[model samples]
Each structure stands twice: as structure tokens, then as C-alpha cells.
Target chain A: MSSGLAQPRIRIPRSARAGEAIEIRTLMEHPMESGIRGANHAAVPRNMLSRMVVRMNGETIFAADLRNGTAANPYHVFFVRLQRSAEFEFVWTDEAGRSVRATARVAVS
Target chain B: MTTASRRALLLALVALPAAARADAALEAAMREAVGPAEPEEGGMALRLPALAENGAQVPLTVTVDSPMTAEQHVVSIHLFATRNPTPGVASFHLSPALARAEVQTRIRLAEDQQVVALAVLSDGRVLRATAETRVAVGGCLG
Candidate 1:
């Protein structure tokens, strides 16, 4: 089944103090079909993002395992302490093995 | 092996786990993820609106009292909607790099239910909190 999800959107402040905690927000567009029968009586074939991983300069900072109960267009906001200028990578993977990734750069002053 | 048989095998393997997971209750999943330790009540807090006009996008926040230093930090936070069709809302893994034990997100609450937040610390201590919210409009079915 085609997931029909657009690229994920991630927002991180461009820079932060070396020891400051910063908030990172992300959102992805997805149908999150629950595999339950619809009004037409056809199974929707559950297709939800099963996993999400965030890494900063190759080190995993956050990760999550999602389930079918998650709503469409999963949105998340979390905090991370900035220590150095690095590339932040976000990866989302669905049950079908399809994955979407986004990256942002943060400079620690 | 024939292409069709290989495809069948792959489907079987995938479906097996999915079915097994479906069979496991939400409590079982939480126990499996957090292990047998009983979570304490004070270190974590779960925030949810007392009354939700709509269940589609209810703002939720989870915060834990922790130094978040290298020696002591929260390792993960797991959210659960007690009465939703699926018990597991989301599980978040954290690192010392976060320097704080807090997360904010939007969630869908199927109905009036209690939202639970469970946090695991670096010292293997588990803490939890719960908040009840009344949803007038359904999010899952609607």
C-alpha cells in the first residue's frame, strides 16, 4: 500500500547557547489508516509510522516507536541541549518499510 | 524458491509479529517496554486539558523533575491513552544531551480517558503520572 505521505517538516532554532535547552518541533503528513473497515466496508490496511529516530552528529538523541493509535500527521515537540554545531537528522519509518527523513543544522555559540 | 512463495513467506513473517502485537494488551506492552519495576508517582507530570472540545488534537505535555546531568537523566517517556482503541500513544527515548526531561506534543483522545505518562531514569527508576480529560467530540471514529 502506498503511504502517500509528504516529506516531514522539522523546526529547530538556528543557534543556541552552548548549554541551553532548545525545543525542536516536527510534523509529518500521513493518513494513518487503521486497517479497519470503512463506510464502504473495505479494510483500510493499517499504514502508520512505526518508528522515528532523531540523531545529532551521528549520536541518537531521541527515538520513538509509534502504534496504530497515533493520529494522522504525527506531531512532536521535545527539548535538547545544544553543545556544538551539528547536523540533526530525523527519520520516520512506516510499517511497510517506507521511510522519510529530514535534517536541520544548529550552531551552538 | 519461487518469487510467489518468497513473497508469501515475507508476508507471513510480517503478519505474524503484527498479529502477535495486536493480541498483546496495552498493559502488557507497557510492562514489556518498562520491565517489571513499579513506577513511582512523584517524579513525572502529565498535562492535559480538563475538558477537550475536540479529541482530534489535544495538547499534551509531560515533564519530569530531574537534573538531566550525565550521572542522572531521564532515559525515556512513554505516553498511554488508557481507554483508546490502542493503549500505546507514543514512546520517546531520550539522552543526557537533552538536559531536560520534558516533551510536548498533540495527541488524539478517542473519548474521555486518563492519559498516563511513564518516565524511566538513568538509575533504572521508573516514575509515572496521569491526567484525566473529558473529550466531547471523538477523535478516532470521526
Candidate 2:
């Protein structure tokens, strides 16, 4: 298992119409080694993000299960609609059971 | 058993699954995830560059034509990298509240391979689109 600092980033509009759609972009930094081999020819144990959950005001709007095939510093962008002001929480979990989280707030008009 | 013979046996065991072919494994994974439904041609789109100078961070976008209503919406979206160490890249679950069935992300491509995006709808229909990308340098192994 590889242990390193993970940084999660999210982008959401500061405000939106009550019923309008908004795009949310997210990214996280991790090594995501494939467990194949490194330059020294030693087998590198796989370290990858396994799950991502996005919640809007305590309700899950999107969730994903990632795999080793994902590249390092995985990035995701998706859309969501809200009827009122809410906070969006993003949680990412890796293969080693480590988790990192980030949050963004949007004001619905 | 002789050391040489044991080494040969280990190599043979490793080569067995490696020789099973990559396409077949990918197909099996797709079938397992999305079932046997034949994905329609439209209702989904995959955007990726035709040529990628670096496969480590190939940007990808997938969009499904949906109204984001409770009755008709995309249930899930699955991404696959055909030539990666594993076929299943990621699976996303979405609800009607999303308003739009579009997602974007960065992925790694092992080599010149097809990156497929499959979407399943609430109405029990499947849609798919694929984009072929030629990578000058591999991402996973490099």
C-alpha cells in the first residue's frame, strides 16, 4: 500500500436558478499505481481510488466505483439540479480504505 | 521437480490467462456489468481526442440525451478502457436530480484502444458510444 497526501478539488457555481442545471467538476490526486511494475522492475502494489460519493444536502446525487484502470489524479465532472441552497459533499475512498473529502456550497435562487 | 521445469510451469500458468485474449475479457466484463441488452447507437456520446500525446491524462466526456425527469432518466454510466490493465474504468450512478446525464473525467489509456461509454436508462434501455484514441506513449506501463 502506498500512503500519500490526497487533495480533492470541486467546482460548483456559486448560485443557480432553482430549477436550472449546474455542472460539478471534481478531481483528486493519488498515485494510482497499477501493481504491475516500476522502473526498477519490482512489482508495485496497486493503489487506486475505489469509490466516490457525491451528496447534495444529505441526499446522494451521484456515486461511482472506480478501478485500477483509472489514471493517477482521477478527475470527474457531472451535473446536478437543486431546488434550494445546499451543500455538496464529495467523498473518495481508495483501495487501502483511506478516504478524502471535499465540499462545495451553492445558493439556489 | 527440477528448478528449470518448475519455472517453465509457472511461466505457462501465467501465460494461460494472458493468452485468453483481451477483447474476450473486455466483452465478458461488459456483459457482466450491463447485461445482455444490445446498446443502441444513439442517445449517448463519447468525446475524446483522436490522438493523445500522453495517455496518462486523456480527458474524456460522456453525455446522454435525457430530460432528467423521474420517469425517464439515465440510471448509470459505465466507462471502459479496452486495453488497460483492467477493462472496467469506472461506473457512475445518477438520479433524476442530476438534470443532465453528462460526465467528464480524465483517464489513462494503455495504448491505441477504444474507450467505450455505456449508459443504462430507467426504461431498461442501454446506450453506448465509443471513441478510438491512439496514444503515442502508454500510460499504465510507462
Off by over 4 Å in 2: A1-5, A38-42, B1-20
TM of chain B vs. native, candidate 2: 0.83
Docking band of candidate 1:
acceptable
Docking class of 2: medium
Residue clash pairs of candidate 2: none
- Tens digits of per-residue lDDT, candidate 2, B1-142, equal 3488456656755776553455566777888778989788797889999998888888888999999799999999999988776788888899988979998888888789999888999999999899999998888775
Give lDDT tens digits, candidate 1, residues A1-109.
2445588888889998988888899998887666643133136556778888999999998898876556678888888888778799999998889887888999988
Deviation (Å) of A44 in candidate 1: 2.0
Name the regions of candidate 1 deviating beyond 4 angstroms: A1-4, A37-43, B1-24
* DockQ of all candidate complexes: 0.36, 0.53
Q: Over the stretch B34-142, how does candidate 1's per-residue lDDT look in tens digits?
A: 9988888897879999998888778888999998888999988888887676677888898888867888777888789888888989999999899999999977763
